[model samples]
Target: MAGFDDITKKAQSFLQDGKVQDALKSEKAEDVSDKVFDGVADAVKKVTGGKYDDKIDKARDEADKRIGNE
Candidate 1:
């Protein structure tokens, strides 16, 4: 479906964004905790009415992992 394809493209783009990855590797990012990311993801999921909860969770996990403090 067109919607699914668009979602896939966005997901891939996020995953491939070196700038975001690099930013997440910064010292400030490293000081952030998984709990904070999880809280933010939860807030985002709620704001989106759970429509993009899966994607939000995946992105949060990826970002948290990039910080390398989790």
Candidate 2:
């Protein structure tokens, strides 16, 4: 599942970067967090041809939790 791991890592990076940008733009943290999670989920779904919906949803949930904690 190296490919999946790579995709997850990349998604996380994208979320983190978006968070930073959002913060700079004075966006609410909660809103930014949601946007990041949704964006990642959509990207994962597109990349996997919609074959890994459960995994993507789980990843997005976990990422949201992690981002919220930060």
Candidate 3:
């Protein structure tokens, strides 16, 4: 239910949190990133009345694919 920026901040904090990163190590990075960011994008789209939906969604996808695949 949080906004896109909030989600992004949370994700950044998650990466810096040792325990969370450790837990994430057991999962597929690409799958996890995609799932998480995709949800963030959806939430953002819902709140913004679709004004920036395409751009936000596209950025989310690119970030997910690029970062996850790396």
Give the TM-score (vs. native) of candidate 3.
0.54
lDDT of 3 by residue, 1-70 (tens): 4698899998898788987655555447767877789899999999999999879978986776554444
What are the per-residue Cα lDDT tens digits for candidate 1 across 3-67? Answer: 99999999899967998777666666766656688889989998999999889988987887767
Question: Of the candidates numbered 1 and 3, which has the greater TM-score value?
Answer: 3
Candidate that beats the other on TM-score, 2 or 3, i.e. the better one: 3
Each model's lDDT comes to 0.81, 0.77, 0.77
Best by lDDT: 1
Error of 3 at 57 (Å): 1.6
Can you tell me which runs of candidate 2 are displaced by over 4 Å? 1-27
Positional deviation of 32 in candidate 3, in angstroms?
0.6
RMSD of each: 8.1, 9.2, 8.0
Q: Could you give me the TM-score of model 1 versus the true structure?
A: 0.51
Better candidate number, 1 or 3, judged by lDDT: 1
* Candidates sorted on TM-score, descending: 3, 2, 1
Clashing pairs in 1: none
Cα-based lDDT at residue 52, candidate 3: 100
TM-score of each: 0.51, 0.54, 0.54
